[model samples]
Target: MISDTAEYALRAVVWLVQTPDESQTTRQIAEGTRTPLDYQSKVLQLLAKSGITKSQRGTGGGIRLNVSPDGLTVLDVINAVDPIQRIHSCPLGLKEHGTCLCPMHRGLNDAVKTVEAAFKNTLVADLLKTRSKSVPLGIDLPLRAPRKPKQATA
Candidate 1:
């Protein structure tokens, strides 16, 4: 199973894809994805470090997706925050077991592999095209505040 951080990262990525043209602050992303602001901030930092997203400072600056949604995979987002750890050897470190895993452990590892493959194949753009009525995170919240109209020049 994916970690909560991974789930939050996926939600954040999906939200970003929805508003591809604009950069979003951490607060905006957190509100849109319904994630905790502080936690989301950390997740975004990890993503930026991983090259999945980019951050900018100063006016009109914020975080934005670095990779195209069409090219970005679910695994890319999940791995950016919490990497899926594969069990290669016995978790108990049994001398006899060595690289061989017990039946239960092998099963668990196989499940993890299947999930990883699926995530790797799924693009962020595909999630947005889901047939289900609910959007990612079921978030209907606006990602940005309404902009004020420009005043007439004197």
Candidate 2:
């Protein structure tokens, strides 16, 4: 499973790709991606450190994507925040298991590897090209009110 930080990073990157020519403030990116402002700021900082984004201060200055969306992959964004952890040894610390994982662990690790590979192959720009009716970040959709929970009958 991906961490919230990683998810936020992905959202930030995808959002940036939407307007590659414009520089967006942390607040704007956070609001656009539905991520927390403070958390989004930290995530952007990490991304900038990783050379995935560039930040400028003062008038008309903000954060922008440093790398091209065509060249940037989903794994690149995730790794900038929290790299996918691979199982290298026994998580349970079973002396018998050691470096060789059990069947269950091996299967889980394999599944993770599959996910990692998929992400590595997926470009951030590809998310914008989806033919689905729903758009990523809902940029093209009208805002909708949150649904209220149904009240139980007495």
Candidate number with greatest lDDT: 2
User: TM-score: which candidate is best?
Assistant: 2
lDDT of 2 by residue, 35-91 (tens): 999999999999999999998999978988888777789999999999999999999
Candidate 2 lDDT (Cα, 0 to 1): 0.86
**Model 2 Cα shift for residue 51 (angstroms):** 0.8
What TM-score against the true fold does each predicted structure earn?
Answer: 0.86, 0.87
Encode model 1's per-residue lDDT on 1-154: one tens digit a residue.
7898999898888777666567899999999888999999999999999988888898998988777777788998888898999999999999989998999899999999999999999987777666567766775533332233248899
RMSD of each: 6.5, 13.5
Task: Give the 10-residue window scoring lowest on summed lDDT in candidate 2.
Answer: 141-150
In candidate 1, list every pair of residues with a backbone clash: none
Looking at candidate 1, what is the lDDT of residue 83?
91
Question: After superposition, which runs of candidate 2 have C-alpha atoms over 4 Å from their true positions?
Answer: 141-154
